[model samples]
Target: MKFNRSFAVLLVPLCLAFGLFALAQDSDDRARPAIMGSTIFDWTLLPVKVSEKGESRRVLRAPTATLDELECHVTTLNPGQEAHPPHQHPDEELIIVKEGTVESLVNGELKIVGPGSVIFQAANQMHSIRNAGDTPATYHVIKWNSPGMLSLKKAAKKMQK
Candidate 1:
């Protein structure tokens, strides 16, 4: 076969352009660690266990009204139960399903979620998660409450009750 110099020249710029375009489309992956190793964080490890009303020694309750940024607790839902009775939070929550299946329920509707799955519970909107699977469901829970978020949540909670 005979080679075409003109066709080859045209392809060089096209390949270079593709490479440049791909590099320009990067994502936001910045690291920001507040309390490196403290009980204030949900995703990270804590020094020791703390107790409070509506909380158990093993399971740490939510309502992390700490500050602008707060790490909740790692709630592992075993087979046949909701992480919490259908409830909502004022601040945004990031629920990262680490293992097992998570049946997420929002306002009575059911949503089946599994490992590596996440379901956000919007502030003031009702949401909950349960493990419908046979095994336990583990997840890294992040409940961020910024200043007035807690106050707003308390008011809303009162209204619901």
Candidate 2:
């Protein structure tokens, strides 16, 4: 094959640019933890373990490179079962009901909600959720820490102790 010097010069820069682009993409993926990246979790495939008050499955928990923390899980409570006594924390939490009903007590206000309902509990406000149906109640709980809030992993570990 006959080669041209000008063509070779152009090819060199193209190859270098491609190499640098690929390296940048790989570094971007590595900079963020896998759990902190976008993920799709199938709740049916995850094993359910008994929580302090009911059955639950941890969906995800990871610290992001941006100094934020996320913790999520799905919990199932039997009829009349309470996940925990009324408590308050500094992390904001969101609960999405997937099945049955839940009686939520947020900062002394009570409300009964059903499937597909979303509940937002603000930071440091007393809250509790219990099954308010005849069957088991299932819901997804997603909690995250604000810039000035306490670390979610540390708080969970401390509660376990």
| Model 2 Cα shift for residue 148 (angstroms) | 4.3
lDDT of 2: 0.86
Assess each prediction's global lDDT (C-alpha) against the native: 0.65, 0.86
Give the TM-score comparing model 1 with the true structure, all chains together: 0.54
Show the colliding residue pairs in model 1: 42-71
Error of 1 at 26 (Å): 45
User: Candidate 2: how many backbone clashes?
Assistant: 0
- Stretches off by above 4 angstroms in model 1 are 1-67, 151-161
What TM-score fits each model? 0.54, 0.68
Q: Residue by residue across 115-134, what tens digits does model 2's lDDT show?
A: 99999999879999999999
lDDT of 2 at 65: 53
Question: RMSD, model 1, all Cα superposed?
Answer: 16.0
Model 2 stretches with alpha carbons more than 4 Å out: 1-35, 51-53, 65-67, 151-161
